[model samples]
Target chain A: MEPLLKVENIEKTYDGKKVLNGISFEMEKGNTKVIIGPSGTGKSTLLRCVNRLSEPEMGKVILDGQVVLDKTVEKEPRIDLNAIRSQVGMVFQNFNLFTHLSVLGNVTLGLTQVKGMKRKDAVERAMIEIDRVGLADKKDAYPALLSGGQQQRVSIARALAMDPKVILFDEPTSALDPELIGEVLQVMIKLAKEGMTMLCVTHEIGFARSVADEIIFLDEGKVLAHEPPEQLFSNNSSARIRTFLKKISELYGGE
Target chain B: METSSGLMIIWESWPMFLSGTITAVQLCILFLGVGVVVAVPVSLSQIYGGKSLKFSASVFEQVFRGLPALVLLFLFYFGLAELDVSPLVAATLAMGLRSAAYQSQIFRGAILSIDSGQMVAARSIGMSRIRAIKCVILPQAIRLAIPPWSNEFANMIKDTSYVFVVGIIELMRQGRYVVAGSFGNALLVYSVIALIYLFLTYCGLFLMGRLSKKLAIPGFASAGAAMERI
Candidate 1:
């Protein structure tokens, strides 16, 4: 079957430095694809480009057979940015929940405004998502009142509330306290078990190993290796991948 | 003897004094309401509107903020009268327009102070740009704007005295009229007028202080309280 999302030869530059240099990848439906790399490896940039938050200098991003970023296509290319964004929900590293809004408000905002649902119906749906993340009790609380772990869980619930076909997580647990990381990872593990399509950029090799169907190790804006977690972690195909895996293993754990 | 006469003057002039104060308060409230109505949208446009629109809004803000309120009132009352405009209309326009400019700056600062992440979060969740700004950004920005807006309200009340130049018989104008009619009781009249203005300003500040306390983020309040103790 064709991939759900295809990124072909995508390149991006910022002030003469190449961030994503002709990088390409594909994600199948209901699979978790983890892009693992060190800082400044352009993992976030790659995700941004795929979500069209940042325009790629060159290449095409095709989602469900729709050309998102094909420069050579038409004179006045039609891109429904909001539609693409709705289809691909993103969870930020900082858990950028609206501090001004209640947890339920944050989750139901898109449903009421974008999807044109009734306020009552939106609240009901939002409550279900909040309950899914075990934050139903805190639904009326603002983000400032929540713990970092709870805030991240609320962020996930907010994303899930949109009912997107694919979710993108950019270092979802990196900003959390070490003790809180387990809760967020557990949430991700549950989502993976339910077969949610996800492309996560993370440093949590353990979460990646436990949840990801495929691992893509990136270095210097290029995909150094792509394989199943078992082969990618144990066999170590590329020298860079081996070095990265070794360092991560030491930092996180063994196995 | 003079102190006794001053007391007698105040007692005798109580009705006129009370009427003038009431009119002045009414005028201040009216102008503030008009100003806010004009300011909120203009400020939003200035912050989120396109470059050309922002530029135009900036020009409107500068023209009103840069000019003295007295000068603006004079320009509206007298200058526009030259073109056959009514004095009351000119006074309303001048006060409302000038207050709009000042209030816009207050709102602009408040809007900018909000985290950009909020807007990003709203948009990422499928809200259109306009809807996100309306639902997410404006509510927080307006809440944060309350403190500065109270300052603006205080300024507006004080500045309503400028409408006296247009011969609109508000408090200051009434004071001038009473002093002139009372045969050179300028000191007594002006003192009463000053007291009235002070009372209005103090009330505004007091109300705003309470509002700010209520609207402040808990973290901010705790930090501020901590700093105050230190």
Candidate 2:
């Protein structure tokens, strides 16, 4: 079978500086890929480029055998970004919940507005997702009233409600407090156990080690190593990778 | 003249003042109703439209906000008189047009105040930009705009008095008529009219305040009000 999401030779720039230089990756169905890197290493940019949020200067992004983005084409394939995005869910670092809406409203907005599902059906599906994230009781509450973890969970439910083929998580737990990170990680681990296709950018080495099928260590817009957790963490032969791992362990220990 | 005659003059002139109040209120509503309608597009264009559209919106804002309301009233009333535009229509257009410029700025500020992430989150779910604006952004922006937008109501109501220059018999014009007709009892007549003006302004503010309170977001209180509590 074709890879679920394939990103080819993605390059991006800010001003005259290259941010993502010739980055490429592919994920098979049900595979969970975690991207780990220090700040400003184009990890987030790589994820954004997949969805054309930060348009790549040169790239081809294919999702489930469909060409979602082809930056090489002058007039490109007239694809609707909204239609493409509807199938690709993105969970942000800030939660980015619609503050004006209730938990249930936030989860169901895309379903009702984008998918044109009936109100009753959307509510039912949203309820299931909200319940799955353990936020069933807080459906009527607004984002302001919820804790950081709860709000992030709601955002996750919002993305899941779209029934996306693959979910892109951009540091989903980086914004949460230390005590609150476990609940979000637990939810994600459960998704992984159920074989959800996920592309996550995070520094939580503990969650990553336990959950990632393969971890891609990115540096300066290039993938330094792409290997399973045991090989990269247990027996990393490269001094640069070892030094980076040591610094990350010292700062945010592998809990 | 005895105080009794002064009271009698006001009592007799009550109908005139009442009619004047109605016209003033009518004009105020029309100007602001149309002002808000015009402001949405103007503000959206300034913030989201292309270069020429943004420039046009900015030019409109600058020209109208810089010119005095009285000047605009005169230009529309007398300048367009040859075209058979009535004083009322000219006054409405002039004041409404200028109010739209001010209101557009007010709304643009409110729109910008919304988090940029709101649009991203909305679009990530497949919403078109316009749909995101209508559903996710504007609801919050309009709620946030209430306190600032209310000032426009008060400003336009007072500005409606300028229409008297073109001979529309609104509140201020009726007050003048009352004083002149009552043999220069300017003190008593003007006092009653002032009280009436005060009453109308207070009522408008009361209603708007109630509306603002009703629509305010739970945590996102108006910055000025929140600052006061702190």
Candidate 3:
């Protein structure tokens, strides 16, 4: 099958400094790809570029089959940004839950506002995702009242409620307390097992070891290593990969 | 003797004082209503609108906020008299426009103070810019704006007396008439008028407090009233 999401030669810059230097990757349907690297390796930028949230200076991002951003086409390419974003959900480092909205409202906002679903129908649809994230009982609670772990789950449910084809997790659990990280990781693990297509930028080595079909190791805006967990973890793997893995494992112990 | 007679005159002029106070209160309400109507777009333009829109809003802020309310009232009432402006319209436009400038700044500050994360989250869910602002940004920004907005309300009340120059017969104008008729009662009438202004300010602040408490989200009470429990 054609890859569900294809990112090719994406070059981005910030303040005259290259952030993403010619990065390329692809993901088949139901594949969970984890990108790991030290801070500022352009992992988060890569995910943001997919949805055109952060415009790239050069690249072609194809989602399912359509081009979302092709900077080379013209001086300025004007794609349907909101439409592309609707199909590719993103969970941020910060939970970024709408402070004013309740959990149910957060989940249903996209449905009712963008998809034009009736209020009653949107509530019905959002409830499924809320239950999936185990926040069904707290649906009426506002984002401000929830704990970091609970808030991240609600954010996940919010993205899932959009019925997106693929979801991007940008350091989803990085902001959670060490003990709270497990709840969010478990949710992601379950999603991976249930065959959800995800591109996650995370530091959790245990999660990458368990569920990542391919771990893409990025550094200085380039993919240094991209392979299955077993191959990447094997002794014959590059010392660079081993060193990085050792460091991450030390910071975040294996599951 | 003068003090006793001053009280007697003030008592007799209750009807005039009441009418004048009512007009002054009405002016403050209209000032806020018009201020918000203009401020919302002006403030949003500076932040989200294009280069030219930002420039235009900036010019408005400079022109209105730079000038004194007294100067604005004079310019509108006397300078624009050929355009057929009434005293009430003059005062409303003068103070309302000025109030808009200040309120816009308050709103912009509140909107900016809200982490940009809010906008990112809204857009990630596929909400258009306007929808995101309406549903996400403004809800929190408006709550944050309340504390500073109360300041604007209090300021506008005292400035309503500036309309007395154009002869609107509001609180200050009524006080002037009482002093002219009673002679030597200026101190008594003006003192009572000050007390009345203080009462109006108190009421306005109380209302703002209630509004802030009602709108505050559970964990993020950035600029809502301090009297949340009460």
Relative to the true structure, how large is the alpha-carbon lDDT of every model?
0.84, 0.89, 0.90
What's the residue-level lDDT of B54 in candidate 2? 98
Instruction: Write one digit per residue (lDDT tens) for candidate 1, span A127-246.
Output: 998999999999888787788999999999989988988899988988888899889989999998999999999888888888899998888989888888998877647777788778
How far residue B122's Cα lies from its native spot in candidate 1, in Å, is 1.1
Clashes of each: 0, 0, 0
Model 1 clash pairs are: none
RMSD of each: 2.7, 1.7, 2.5
Model 3 bad stretches (over 4 Å): A75-78, B222-230
TM-score, prediction 2: 0.97
DockQ, all candidates in order: 0.53, 0.74, 0.75
Give per-residue CA lDDT, model 1, range B1-230, as digits (tens). Answer: 76666667777887888888888888888888889998988898899889998999999999998998888888887787768877677888889988999999888887787777778777777677888888988877777777668878888888888887777878887787777666667888899889989998999889888888777653434422332243
Give the docking tier of candidate 3.
medium
Tell me the deviation in Å of residue A177 in model 1: 1.1
- The better candidate by DockQ, 1 or 2, is 2
Task: Please give the range of 10 consecutive residues that has the lowest summed lDDT in model 3 chain A.
Answer: A70-79
